[model samples]
Target chain A: MLEAIINILSWLLLLAGGAFGIIGGIGLLRFPDFYSRMHAAGLTETLCAICIIFGLVLQAGISLLTLKLLLILLFLLFTAPTATHAVARAAMIDEVEPVLSEDSPRLVDYEDRP
Target chain B: MRDTIFLIVLLALLWLAISGIYKPAILLLGLASLVLVTWVVIRMKIIGEEHNPTVFAWRLPRFWLWALREIVISNIHVARLVFRPEQISPRIVYQNVHFQRPLGKVIYGNTCTLTPGTVTVQLTKSGTVIHALDAKSADSLAELERRVHWLEGETDEVAAKDAGEERR
Candidate 1:
C-alpha cells in the first residue's frame, strides 16, 4: 500500500511539473517583450525543475540518486536567477527597451538618484 | 586562508558525496583535482567570506524557508498570468537597498529574480533596478527587503548605521 502511495504521489508531482513547463513554453511565445519572457523561462528554471526533480527523488527512493537529484535542484535554484539577472542586465545596458503597459516612454535614469 | 580551507573542505565533501567509489586511487585523484581547483581560484582572488557570507549564519535556514514559500506562491501567481496574459501589467521600479556587503546586495537582487513575475534588471553602485510583471510583485518586494535586512543581522537601518556598517 505504501509503495503504491509513493508511486501515485510521484506521478502527480511529475504531471504537475510537466504542466508548468508547458505553460512556461506557451508564455515564452505569447509574452510581448523580452523581459516578460524571462519570467516565463524562470518558471521553468525554478518551479518546474524543482517539481520534476523532487518527483524523481520519490521514484528513486532513498539512495545516492536522490542526493544527486537534490544537489542538482539546489544548484539550479541558485544559478538560474543569477544567470537570468546577467542576461537582463546585459540587455538593459545595450538599450533594449521594454514595451511597458503604462505611459512611461523609456526607462528613467536611476544612476544619480539617492 | 580560511576561505581556501573552507573551499577545500566543501570540495572534499562534495567529491566524497558524489564520487560513490571507495578506492584509494580514485580518492587521490579527487584530492589532487580539488587542490588544483582551489589553487586556481586563489590565484583569481575571487573566493572569500563575501561569496560565502551566509554559509555560517544561523538565521539562513529560516530565511530560506521564507523565500521558498514566497517562490511557491509567486509561481502560482505567475502561472495564473500565463493563463490570462491580459493581467500582465509590467513596469520597472528603482529600489534603494541598504545592504553593506556585496553578498547581501547580490542575495537581495538574486532573490528578487528568483520569484516569478519579478526580475532584478540591474544592480549598480547606486542601487537596484527591478522589473515587476504586476503590482503585487512590486509590493511584495518590500517584504523581501525587510527579510534580507534581518538576514544581514541588522534589525533596522538605524541599528546598522549605528554600528558603522553602512556603506555603498
Candidate 2:
C-alpha cells in the first residue's frame, strides 16, 4: 500500500512538472518580450525538471541511476540561480530597461540618494 | 592513410548496427566495418584528449541536474510574480561573447537557447546577439556563463597561456 501511494504521488508530481514545462514552452513562444519568456522558461526548468526526475527516481527503485539523478538535481539547484542572476546583470550592464507596471517601486530614486 | 580507412570502416559498422536487421552476413559486414574504422582513427590520430569521446561523459547528468534546480527556483519566482506581482522585471537585452573558439561559442549560445527566456538571435566572429526574455533571464545567462567557464577549467592561467600562444 505504501509503495502504491508513493508511486501515485510521484506520478502526480511528474504530470505536474510536465504541464509546467509545456506551459513554459508556450510562454516562451507567445510572450511579447525576452524577459517574460525567460521567466516562463526558468520557472519551467525548476518545476518540470524536479517533477520528472522525482517520478523517475520512484520508478527506478533505488539504484545507481537514482544517485546520478540526485546529483543532477543538486547541480541544477546551484547553477540555475547563478545563471539567472548573470543574465539579468548582463542585461542591466547593457542598459536594458525593465517593463515596469504603474505601481512598481522606483529604484532610480534610491540610486539618486547616494 | 590508416585514419581514412578506419573512419570509413567505422561509419560502415555504425550504419550496419543502427540498421537493426538480424542478418548473419550483415553482422559480419558490420564487424568488419568497425575494425576498419578503428584502424583509420588510430592511424590518423583523430581521437585525442582534446577530441576525446570520454570528455563529455558527464555533461548529460550535469545538464539534467542543472535543469531541475532551475525549475524549482524559477517556479517560486514565477509564483511570486503571479500572486504578489512584485518580483518580475521583464526586459530584453543583447550581450557580447567572450569565448574564442567556435565550439565554445556555439555551446554557450545553444545552452542559453535551451533555457527559458533566452534565444540566440545571431552569432558572429565578433560576438553573439541574444534576445533575453527578461532582465532576470538575462542575468541568469551571465551567471550560467561563469559556471560554464568554471566547468571548462578556464582560469587566469589558461587565459594567459592563450595570450602567450597568440603573441607567437
Assess chain B of each prediction and give its TM-score.
0.88, 0.54
Two-chain complex of model 2, DockQ on C-alpha atoms against the true structure:
0.15
A39 in model 2: Cα distance from truth in Å?
6.7
Per-model CA lDDT versus the true structure: 0.85, 0.59
Off by over 4 Å in 1: A103-105, A112-114, B50-56, B156-168
DockQ metric for all predictions = 0.55, 0.15
Poorest 10 consecutive residues by lDDT, candidate 2 chain A? A105-114
Candidate 1, residue B15: the lDDT equals 91
TM-score of each predicted structure versus truth: 0.90, 0.50
Candidate 1 chain A: 10-residue stretch with minimal lDDT? A103-112
List candidate 2 stretches off by more than 4 Å: A1-9, A25-30, A33-57, A60-114, B1-51, B56-64, B75-90, B156-168
When summed lDDT is taken over every stretch of 10 residues in candidate 1 chain B, the lowest stretch is B158-167
Docking class of 1: medium
- What TM-score does candidate 1 get on C-alpha atoms? 0.90
